[model samples]
Target: MMKRFKTAAALMTAGAMVLSMAACGSSSKPAETAQTTEAAASSAAETGKAEATEAKKEDGAKFKIGVLQLVQHPALDKANEGFVKALDDAGLSYEIDQQNASGDQSACQTIASGLVANQNDLILAIATPAAQAVAGQTSDIPILVTAVTDPEDAGLVEDNKKPGTNVSGTSDLTPVKEQIDLLRRVLPEAKTVGVMYSSAESNSVLQAALAKEACEANGLTYLDVTVSNSNEISDVVNSLVGKVDAIYCPTDNMIAAGMATVSMVANENRIPVICGEEGMVDAGGLATYGIDYYQLGYMTGKQAVEILRDGKNVSEMPIGYLDQEKCALKVNEETAKSLGLDPAAVK
Candidate 1:
């Protein structure tokens, strides 16, 4: 995809260069042909000059973009990459200042302030915390948020369909009921599941509630385990070792970052960990029927281009969502093996 974008940009540039060179070559033609070539050369030169001017105008309109990410986890990182790739592919001229809060609220506030001070043309917030921080700093700046569970629940937007504000983007809200069902299919004998996430993250709290409802509907009992930060991850997961048959982890930033720790303890106890997204499965989870963060980010990036290049109103832009077809089964075969489960069977 990147190669395609670069090639398209190169072709646009090459067209102007070729036309200019043609006009110059025509100028050096013989006197006999000069009479004929003169008219042609003059026309060619004018067209070439016009095209060059237009190209220069496009190149000169460089947008200033700021990216505020909540942490350094793979899911958020992939979303960030996808967003940037969209800008590059669109051939939009822009400069970006990317900042990560490293899962700290104070750091998020500080970074948000700097971005607002810099007065960026657009801001891409990778998670709920980053979105809230940036949104609090300015209501005028066009903000695009990705990897968030429920934009309405997070208080980032007035409504998901019509943001009615300067904030709008993609949601990483995976199919919670389907995921819970996946856990049941993977562990037929499992009766109790541990729903784990960081209590401080509102998105996680929302997902935890959904997981609980899903569990009840699926005729399974659930145990709620909350941690405030990464340091408490291992201990919390360890506490669930013998208490639950399996674990359901949400797309929480802190828990995503500490997935390895969670998997280490859970797998050691022969407990399967079903995650909310592919990155968590890759990190160490047994499986997940979840959305792709890269695609979600790319979806958001397309929205960025619509606002920055097309001059579309940010407030009226509806929240973007990946279709159910975009969700796929992702499994860590090694983790599945360790838990004495067949990866093929889960799929």
Candidate 2:
């Protein structure tokens, strides 16, 4: 597979060297010849290619995307994968410069500032904080956010229906009410549900509020437990161990990353956790009405194409949401059984 690349690279280098030699040895054969013209043509073609390549190097493609991700976690990673996959499917040429904030808001600010300075053709911000950081920096550059629960609440857009700014993209707003109801169906006799999320993420805070409301609407008591970061996750989970009959985790990045600990504590207490997304369910939450992050990102990528290729204004583009079909009912049989609930009945 790499053989052609090596051959082509060698030919390009050779053409450049021959062009240089011809210039130095021009006096020896001052008159133009067919052979000299051919060499000159080949050299000129190579030079043009070199210039094009340099432009590609500087911008990646005529279309460049600077991606700012809030953290290195499974759900966000999948969203980024889907965003790239959509761009690939569209057959559009693009360059992606991805930066991970490693769960640090300060890192997100620095990365967002650099991306704005680079003057990329577009910006892909994953998660709420990442989107907020980029939106805070520049108003001129087009920014598209993925995996955000509420873009308007995060202040990334003026309206969910119409952005009215250079910010728009997919929202991974999982069905909180449906998830809470599913928890009820799984554990009917259950009384209290602990809602866990990161206090720092506006998305999580918003989702937690929605989840709490849903719990109240569905005749279930809700307990709110929040952590500022992963370091506080285990202790938080432990504190909720015997206090709640079940746990309902929101579409939160920090909670999603530390779900293993949450699950460990939940399982030990025989509490089934109903998560906001599928990755959390897979991470050991009993079940969820979850959205596929990849599909969310893929849809966002298509939106990006409209802006880059069709000159659509981000300000006019409405924020996108995953269809209900994109969100599915997923239950972990093993977790269900361990909690003494019949898997089918849990469904």
Candidate 3:
């Protein structure tokens, strides 16, 4: 009986030992599964962090540009288009706030004040008056001027080689001699050249002076028919009809705005007009020998990019000219026909 009792006890002890070993093995497996789940969750969290970092990099890469154009004329419009294209080429997104002054100097000043208040990254001034307004409003903001005849005359810059101020941009002034030569080429018999421009416009005055010098060199007589405002355009144009053989239109914003009226009167009197910009040619002027306004805007856009992205000083950057290769002769067939002039004769 004693031996049987001892055997039963030993059997109970072995069974308990086996059960304990099985419980420990099962607990070990659950602990390993828990560790694996924690590791996967940690890896997923790290991946999320990396994606968020990349998204931030993408979100931080953009810029802002503000454009102040004098009017909606073709030359200034083309320059604005060129500026947009330049920004697009650089893969930078920009917010452009464009304002047209409708040929009002006070309106330009008001718009420029608002832009400066907004703290725009850069300002693009399309004409002489517009550039002057922006420069007067803010010295901290860089101003890029286009379609402006002479920055110096406009008082936007000290010199072309060294801007010496916060303003710099492309000049629309092509060689004055080339323009005079073009006039003579198109109208070989025209001895007396009549010029109508806004006397208030400094750019117009500078162009008039240059045109006068050019005409003198070519043995062509020049007559000044200056007008101070839009109201005087018709009178100025009518006054020059019989006295002058041909009319020369400078890149005066006021004159450009009133081109349709000027064209109607000039064409009625059988006078052919040679303008400084392609827009005037399109507006009923006979022809133009000038730089592409859009190309000038694009050139200015590049300078703006440098000032914004490359940390370059605007005062240090020399004013740049648009590539002259972009300059060309644009003639109007309808105007030529109406004036009894041949288009092919001008080129």
**Overall lDDT per candidate, in order of appearance:** 0.89, 0.87, 0.84
Q: Per-residue lDDT for 218-259 in model 3, tens only?
A: 899989889888988898888886799998888888888889
What's the lDDT of the predicted structure labeled candidate 2? 0.87
- The C-alpha stretches of model 2 lying farther than 4 A from their native spots are 1-61
Best by TM-score: 1
lDDT by residue (107-155, candidate 2, tens digit) is 9999999999997878999999999999999987889999998899888
Query: Model 1, stretches more than 4 Å misplaced?
Result: 1-59
What TM-score quantifies how close candidate 1 is to the native fold? 0.83
Q: How much is 89 displaced in model 1, in angstroms? A: 0.8
Higher-TM-score candidate of 2 and 3 = 2
- Deviation in Å, model 1, residue 63 alpha carbon: 0.6
What is the alpha-carbon RMSD of candidate 2 to the true structure? 18.6
Best by lDDT: 1
In the order shown, what is each candidate's alpha-carbon RMSD? 21.4, 18.6, 21.5
Better of 2 and 3 by lDDT: 2
TM-score of each: 0.83, 0.81, 0.81
Candidate 3 TM-score, true structure as reference: 0.81
